[model samples]
Target: MTIHRMLARLAALAALALFAQPAFAAECLLGAPGTTQRVEVSDTGRAMTVHVPGGVDRIRNLPLVFLLHGSGGTGAAMLESSGLAATSDHHGFLLVAPDAGIPVERGFVWNIPGVPTITGEIPTEDDADDVAFLAGTIDWLAERGCIDPDRVYATGLSGGGRMTSWLGCVAADRFAAIAPVVGLRAGNPLPDDPQRPDPATCTPSRAMPVYAFAGADDTVNPVAGGGAGYWQYPMDAALARWAEIDGCREEPETVAVSDTIEERRYARCDGQARVVGRVVAGRGHEWVADNEAMWMFFWRYRH
Candidate 1:
């Protein structure tokens, strides 16, 4: 082979390499075990705390869970109230909680679509940009090492739950599964009133696995409509919508998990998706299970 021919072949190979998949790299700094470390989301100055599990050094390919708080709540509050950090410690998964910045007391509120606050005001899109912050958090974590890209999951309470549903709708490509505690049905068309913002446009990238919970006695986001002007629908209706989105077969199997809990499981879904709803009897708007059920549900899925 001539020198010119060899040089041309090398250049061609180099050009082709540019189009190939790049190797994974961890650019962000890692956190310490059993501690919560705050990190900036971006130039936006939005911040979050990542709770590294106690045994992180011994685990590889860890699953990452984004735990969001309700309206007027903060990451610190969620970590304290949800009992998720202990769950993370027990399960060896990473947990992250981001601030929403709608200060009500010591906490904040996530700016979910169409949902207004107690004062009947909705935060504009640019006001929170939670979707971007979440996406950036995931990317930053993935780039930092020990994260299993396929094992990403999200769960939250009230406003945070709505945010989780939004992530399932808009960022489904990145999350393996989601559990929203008392969140609304994403992409369910709203009433034809022009005054209201259109329901969030849901375009899931895959047949997503969803395990949701709702309280029978909840009034904040009631099973029936008309409560503080927040989005309201029966738990069955929300589950049905998710089942349709997940391509599950009709007629879910119902089972009594406990005296206070009944589960409805959708079967034969495309892409191994499982859509489930758990109705908590005689309960109100709350994180009924310390988020253990959500973790178990999330554990079953991986992208």
Candidate 2:
């Protein structure tokens, strides 16, 4: 072969090798099971912890669940305590735990729309839009983590739970289902009556399936209502509003989930959507959701 021809061939080979290396690295980052990494989600410095239990060579079309943390909490803390990571490992799904943009003390809190945060600060235009961040996370995972866009779900705790409900309200089309623990909401409270949910604040584009878990003894977000500006109404009011939105048959049924766990559910709704709430007796304002049950519930829907 001529020296010039050989040099051209070597250049082409080098270019191919150069281009292939990053692709392989990205695949290894995504496909290796039990591997966790901290990723900067977008151009912004907002951090996210992603656990990819999928394949490197072939995309798994795996369901994705965003495990949001409570206020004054970080994504790492949520990943460690929520047990949803292990659940994802068992279920063969991708788990993403992301930090909210607003820094609070040692952690962060979500900038829920039109509601004051746990720090009593109402978000303005300057605050990072958490809803967009999370919704964008769906796109991110689909591109890099072998995620199924139709099977995305979200579950969160405390402030994070309220964020989950807000996502259900605003981004229902993106998520198949939502389970909010300890912080269920239907937007802000009625200006006149703080004990009722404001219907106009949260208008879902379509029917959304909701399963909320709470504790009977939790004074922070009591089922019967009355808390901070963001949590002014009872959990029942939120459920009822969602029931009304889903066009569920009125007069929900109450049953015993167990000797200590009580469930009230609204069924026969539009698109077969159901609104359910479970209260654990002697529990408090903390993470008490059954993770397996949440995955089972999430497994039912696909957008």
Candidate 3:
């Protein structure tokens, strides 16, 4: 071949290879190993995306982690941004990211105010049965096999983070541990006012391990924000309340890891569940890169 023609052909081949690389990687990323399966599991028309590591058999009980997305986010976005799927691939666990079922202007939202009652009240468009949907999802995963029922855990950001708190309070029986990022309890007031429900009545079925992370400077959910609107309770106060709920006797030991990350842990609680709070120094409303550390914290507790 002529030198000029050979050079042109080589450049075209390189471009083709470059384009093929991402397509190949995406296929692998969205397939069997290190990928997710989309599932629709209810007459209620609820849908979820489940990511299972390759070669995981239905016989062995594998650890399951639920990664929930924030407001204006989707299951795929959470899996991509939180890096939990990569963690799942490395840690050999099954990761599931379920859609919140709320249609926002951009993406989807978790129905924070949509929890149901036994009165058979139908859920409105804004209302979602996220608690039941999650419970049902876990049950579905358990039936599929290879999932350890005792090791089911959950974590989320923003609105999803709020849903994680709701799961901890209302669906504690199903989850062994939970980590809510930049989210707090709705703490709805008591009485069956269709407008507001009490947070006090939403007691947990068991003491599950909880590791909370919030930026001291988070304007979206500030620790000092009044009432249940934002972070509501001060950071220390929220940790204290959780400690009290879990019956944790050990005082918090604060350890500054760096200029941007601080770790505070409360151990020796009832059911051996511990509460660890990470106060990100000078950070705002975002996920900490140390989520692997958070997962490690959540993995310690078993049902």
Give the whole-model CA lDDT for all candidates, comma-separated: 0.78, 0.86, 0.71
Model 3 per-residue lDDT tens digits across residues 1-303: 999999999999999989888331111122456557786764658777778776543324678888888877888888888877777766778888888876666677666554332222324765766777888876665665547788988889877777787788778888888898887453433344422335474578777688888887788767655433333455566566677778898888998878878877898998998887787878778886376786687677787
Better of 1 and 2 by lDDT: 2
Q: Residue 128: error of model 2 in Å? A: 0.2
Best by TM-score: 2
Clashes of 3: 7
Clash count, predicted structure 1: 4
TM-score of each: 0.84, 0.88, 0.77
- Estimate, for each residue in 1-303, the C-alpha lDDT of model 1 and write its tens digit: 999999999999999998786865755454677888887765667788788898766435689998888877888778788889999998999888888756676777776565575557877665666777788777767776657888999988888888888888888889999988887556534556422223346668888888888888888877554455456455676677778888887689999998989989998898888898887899999986537778888888898
Clashing pairs in 1: 26-143, 72-108, 72-109, 73-108
The TM-score, computed over Cα atoms with residue i paired to residue i, of candidate 2 is 0.88
Better of 1 and 3 by TM-score: 1
